[model samples]
Target: MSKHNVYKMSVASVYPLLVAKAEKKGRTKSEVDEIIRWLTGYSQEELEAQLKKQTDYENFFAEAPKLNPSRALIKGVICGVRVEDIEEPIMREIRYLDKLIDELAKGKAMDKILRK
Candidate 1:
């Protein structure tokens, strides 16, 4: 009588900790593979392909909006808010950012802003 194999599986990107523990216990990759095959039933190649295709950065950057500064800056001396009047530095930082953005909109070189 001949024995027939019914299922096949592959293991890729095994976690280092789990692999270490399994190795110490003398567990074969095929044992893990058989368990995974029974649980998820997904071919290892398919799982690997899906994992490789995952890209958080690509998705995040693709969905993010581009910022334009020309419409967002204010150049003239801003009043109503003074050093003593404003408690937080955040407002002051925003004013400075506005000035820089305005300068950039005017096509001024960054070096010019640094000099000012």
Candidate 2:
């Protein structure tokens, strides 16, 4: 008793890529279709909203949280955070920093900088 569904996604440009992944994973086209169907049980608008929230939270905390300009630095604030907690190792390269700054400089978004 297999409970699966066949559905379509309007991923026009990347449709070929999705098919290629399915093939690479040795899954039938219908199997891929079923997985997509299960995922799409969530409304597109809801998924997009969740994605936006995730993106916003990730961007907001990309840098280490700092003490407010006028506020005192408590022992808890400094001691509670680990080096890895504040700095994401994946984004530690100079190339990444330059690219991030350049993207923000385009005026599309503002990524705050953390000064030690």
Candidate 3:
């Protein structure tokens, strides 16, 4: 799908897939939640509210209470593209989450995966 189409897709629809990816590799959904919270600065309740609202990705990141500055430390490739090299801000945020989930699935420690 094109970037525009991806931006319009509901985060709720995509959330399960992220969770499933980690779960398939013996990770828990809680780890996925922690990753998201670390990246977006969303409290668990706010994250759940966004999911229930079926917010699209563009708005999900846009409306985040505080997009973590530490996210810039999340340097790596996701989908063959180095996330730190992405120019479009929203796309970078998306890829950051993807990379985190990828790390979780790869059995990377939570402290390192979170860039803590």
Most lDDT-accurate candidate: 3
| Stretches of candidate 1 exceeding 4 Å from the true structure | 1-14, 51-116
Off by over 4 Å in 2: 1-10, 42-116
Best by the TM-score measure? 3
For model 3, residues 1-116, the per-residue Cα lDDT tens digits are 35767888888999999999999999999999999998998999999999999999999999999998988999888899999999998999999999999999999999999778
* Cα deviation of 13, candidate 3, in Å: 0.6
* Candidates 1 and 3, the one with greater lDDT: 3
- Candidate lDDT scores, in order, read 0.36, 0.31, 0.93
What lDDT score goes with residue 77 in model 1?
Answer: 46
* Candidate 2 positional error at 57, Å: 20
lDDT, candidate 2, 4-115, per-residue tens:
1211112333334545655565544444333322223324444344344543222322322331331111112222443233343322221232232332233322212211
- Clashing residue pairs in candidate 2 (N, C-alpha, C atoms within 3 angstroms): none
Question: How far is 48's C-alpha from truth in model 3 (Å)?
Answer: 0.5
lDDT of 1: 0.36
Which of the predicted structures, 2 or 3, would earn the higher TM-score when compared with the native? Answer: 3
lDDT of 3 at 1: 36
**Tens digits of lDDT, candidate 1, 12-83:** 222233345444555544444333332233366643453365423222123223322231232354444432
